[model samples]
Target: MPPTVHDRPRDDRGYPVPAITPWEDGRPQFALTDYQRSADCARQRQCSVCDVLMPRGPVWRVVGAAESAAIGAALAAGRPYRNLAPTLEGPGHRACMLYASMVCPYLARPNARRALTAEHPDELTAAVVRGAVRGALGAVVGFADYEFAVTGSRVLFRFVDVIEYLPHDNADAHLAELRAELAGHGGGPARPVG
Candidate 1:
């Protein structure tokens, strides 16, 4: 099940609209939850989790350790943030950020040991641009480096890279837990796996 927007604003149909990922073929794939999209068309203020426009400013993000190391490497290589939505973190309201950190399987699980997984690393690193916020329309423009902070377990990651399924000993259990979290939140039927 997906989150029911009983008291929240949503798309025209009133269902919880998941964030969309545009494929190479231009087809859109909707994630079970809101994932970040380019804020190019004045949409950066949208919360990636709740699929709604953020009512206020001061965007929040949650980055994991894997992405933390990756971002550092990218920056060292001369790649800039340039407003590209971090594969791990994106713009969102305060509440939405909290919701995802507590429930999203990708973040809920303990960080994968980069050393142990070196034999067959499941993560992919890519070069991407990060967008900057400008003006009152909330349109994010200009490709420039942005600063990020890591507080406690939450880190900030703004770049491209897809996380297909990662192979791990407890992968199945983690997926189950994610599904259970979705169901408990009143989201529609759970996908068979993460």
Candidate 2:
């Protein structure tokens, strides 16, 4: 069985840190991820926000122009999205995506700059998946299109793809509309039922 949160050490805030056999061997902190689960569970990828396995199907990512360009270029070139490293945080469900767009501060933040630059991520990305096994986002073995972000170091990483675009200006309204539609279908927010 996978080690429970109690099995891990805690930070000053009492949040679980990474698992370690001994204090000397462990880092001060580690972000918990589905990969940390035991073999059986690790095979399933959990949504970062919902903590549920991402369902299989078309996953969505909210992207800006820069990201769209990368995806387009990769598709045209028939190449895998290549970059310096994997920053993709797995995937998420559509309901989760809608909820996030409505409430996420990052998405709602004012644009730092009007143009893409090397100093910061030119593209904002988020994932929404459907039909995923065990609702696990990590279950996606491969992606057809390539996405990337240009770094100050000039290195690129295989970024996650943006299946859909959610503009910051109208995200709230869009999410509200989606929420109403979902409600009509008896769907609700992605929060835990309990």
State every prediction's TM-score relative to the real structure.
Answer: 0.35, 0.40
C-alpha RMSD for every candidate: 15.4, 12.8
After superposing candidate 1 on the true structure, give the runs of residues whose Cα lies further than 4 Å from its correct spot.
1-17, 21-44, 66-88, 111-194
Q: lDDT by residue for model 1 over 65-132, one digit each (tens)?
A: 44444444555576543335434345554334434444444443454222111222223222211221
Q: Best by TM-score, which number?
A: 2
Q: Which ten residues in a row are the worst by lDDT in model 2?
A: 132-141
lDDT of each: 0.36, 0.37
Which has the greatest lDDT? 2
lDDT of 2 by residue, 37-108 (tens): 322222354433444554544343344334435555665576544334454343344555455444433333
